[model samples]
Target: MKKRRGLSFSQRRAMSGFLFCLPFILGFLLMFLVPMLQSIQYAFSSMQLGLDGIMLRFVGLKNFRTALFADPEYVRTIAESVRDMVLQVPVILVFSLFVSLLLNQKFRGRALARAIFFLPVIVVSGIILEILSTDYLSASIMSGQETIGAFRGVGSYEILVAMGMPQKLIDIMIPVVYDIFNLVWSSGVQILMFLAGLQTVPDSMYECARLEGATAWEAFWKITFPLISPMLLMNVVYSVADYFTTSMNPVIRMINQQTSNMKFEYAAGLSWMYLAVVLVLLGAVYWFMNKRIVYVGE
Candidate 1:
């Protein structure tokens, strides 16, 4: 009898990945599919409450048109959401990677350091984030009700002037500077992801590089970075998603307002548009990063 062929190593790996993702695929189909389709239908229709149930009248983009042309705040909030995502994702990724690198190094209290960095992931939750995002809290801080918030006063502005930055640029950077705490707070998960990736990099590769007279920078650039590129891509996608959907996002707040006011179709339209923007951004990120990402064994 002829010997039967077995799957290739690559084929086995592919099958394993598929099996790992099978639960998520099944969950999405079973739990999310119907609600997602109904929400999409809501984006293009008017809702009516009848004795039977909620009836949807297909309106052919009227809801979308109203959201775009009629609501002034919608456009501004959307623009702000995108702008915040653009600004914060890079900062978050860089900070996460930097902290992860430090955490990956052998040092006293390494475990404690890792735990400290990841504490934000445990401590921050939806309710806490909502409170943090409150306008009243921001106003209180900015108006000097809090000592830390009083940093908004004069020092950074003076430093920027002394350094000769443009006033417009200073205005943008000042808010971002004050938001540093939030940025750092948001990086816990990405840091954990990066740490995982960093740990997977073999010590032998660094030893070999050292024996070859490679500087620490050279070793990092030549070995550590290339090996971690896949995780870098993953963290970037996560950061983008988190920034665009966070409780602090004005766009999401606006959508929630619409929903609360019984404007279900309008809210659906807003959410769908927001989702479209996020999907496009994630697609662009994947396209740009995929070519740069180095997979193991590749």
Candidate 2:
């Protein structure tokens, strides 16, 4: 009898990946799929929570119409969120890449520095973050009476205004700068991803570039940037999703408010609309980035 053929390396790797993801696939189908389908049904109908259970009546997109046309704040909040995301994603990616580069270098207290930077990823749950923002921790770390007064007295925006920057420009930048700390805190995972990507770059590539008389800047653009482009794309997608789902996001808060007010049908419609927007934005970003990604193995 002929011997059975073994799986090829690529096939084996693909099988392993699928095996790892199988549990998640099963869990999503078993636990989430039914509820999600029900939510979609809810979005297209009117739901009343009676003593018996939820009573759903076919409404034929009335909830969607009400959410889009009648609700004053939904569209404006969505617009604001989209604008914030466009501004924030780039800043977060750049900041994460910069910090990851710094962390990748060998130095005294490097482990400590990395731990400090990554602490947010471990501890930044909704309740903990709210407590931190409300309690003395925020006052001590993020702002203080003296610090607030100092910034108001001699703020960067004031300096820019003095230097002949337009009020419109200052207005745009001030909020971004004011929330810089929050941005940095949200970058922990991206920073970790970049650091991991940097570590995967072979030292020999940099050594060869150095031998070829490449400057540090040239070497980075030619070698490091291309190698890490995949991670950059990942960070962008992750940051966008993270920003949308975070507790402080007004869109998420609005959804919660709707649910609390027993407006389930409206909330379901709003959530579906929000999910569509996120999918569209992410699809565009992925298409743009996928074209530029350099697969070193390929």
Candidate 3:
């Protein structure tokens, strides 16, 4: 009987995907969209709390002007945040990738090693992490001479001093060196993502490369790197977002300070600007990396 035709496989698959995403779409619209719109409105308006609630008055570009010209520290803090992001993201990526490769190798206590690497992600999260920073738990526990952050950097700084390197070079290296522990802590998620990607590599490909007399390095470049390129892009995006949003980020701290001092409109404007900057960076990264990512079938 000439009744009805069902949807094609592709159409059905697309429908399924849409259904899977529907909840998130609805949530974004229903829950998050209003606040986001309000934030944009707040950015351009002067807001004051009254007996009722937030009272917003149209202020046009005043908040933006305040942030850009009136406040010197705002731009400086943002610049520092961006500078730290540029310095940190690559180091974190390389460190996580290298450690993932090591942990993927056949060895005793490999699981333990992976767990050790990942422990920070579980432990150093949320307000707990904030409380455990230098001003809090660290200050309470560490002696004057044995401060954790200083202790970690002191050895490296001394070694470099002994080496008679240029002061400018030493100044550069010292920050990166001092942040070694922080980098490690921040790397836990990236390391885990890399391990997931590494596990997806088929053993047969490596075996074939070995049979073809390819060295480990050649195998890595030819096989592993191409395959893991996708995950590398993911890690880059993640690291960028994490760096910009972390508790230690000066930009965020500045915004929080504004909010705390009841500078709601100004805070909103600063936040919107920061969000735009981050979004632009993320868009550029995704575009560049998406072009380079290798799919197995391709």
Candidate 4:
């Protein structure tokens, strides 16, 4: 064979990277990018099942107008969903990190505890979740019928009732505290991520801090928190998205309503709008947290 041309290091790396990303790029374009652009076009069009099946014709921005203004229920549903995600995500992140720290400690039955924590993720989806939330199961096991039946006989409810709370106060307190329970319930992934990050931290750093007369709280603030912050960010984004897409998410209930009502175009518009809102929220989180992320390797 003739002498082969040699590639430079950057050129070789670029080629390898591009080759690795090629499948992802192709999938994104075919599965997401194309479908998204088509959805945007369809959002401005009236869709109906004609003789030839579904037909689309342009109606400009009527869909957006209807969704954003005229469709009262859709707007209200979106607002409620946004509120829920915002409230739940931070709670999940903090709880998950704490759990991760506990799990990472040298203790008995750690593996079993981790498995127990991850059970919800497996159990709380599809048919199993549906069966669990049914009237028979709820009345028998879950105590009260609230969001996901998480707050059946908890102390929060007992305390509210003992305080002689009003009807509305009891109603709100049930779901709010149940949501905190739910947050802790689904924190396994974040815990795993935080555990991994915690593992990567050098023991020498903690040793140095201890030698410098740093207390446990001081070590956490100065060493643990900063070093593992990237994982915290990851967990935050994941928790936010997870909470919004959870089986008990009310926004999903709205989407199911739109589908059942045969408002496909409206549903599509709502989905795209919700996606934009999620992206913006994550972007805000990234922007706010980027400055605080300490590069431990540096």
Best by lDDT: 2
Tell me, what's the RMSD of every candidate?
6.4, 5.9, 5.7, 5.4
State every prediction's TM-score relative to the real structure: 0.77, 0.81, 0.78, 0.76
Runs of candidate 2 exceeding 4 Å displacement = 1-8, 126-178
Q: Residue by residue across 32-97, what tens digits does model 3's lDDT show?
A: 999989889999999888999989999899999988899999889888888979897999999999
Q: Write the per-residue lDDT of candidate 1 for residues 49-145, one digit (tens) a residue.
A: 8999999899988988887899788888888778877887898899899999999889999999999888878767676645754655444432224
Question: How many clashing pairs per prediction, in order?
Answer: 0, 0, 0, 0
- Regions of candidate 3 where Cα sits further than 4 Å from its true position: 1-31, 51-53, 126-177
Report clash pairs, candidate 4: none
lDDT score, candidate 1, position 220: 90
Model 2, C-alpha of 232: deviation from truth (Å): 0.7
Better of 2 and 4 by TM-score: 2
lDDT of 1 at 139: 41
Write the number of the candidate with greater lDDT, choosing between 1 and 4: 1
Better of 2 and 3 by lDDT: 2
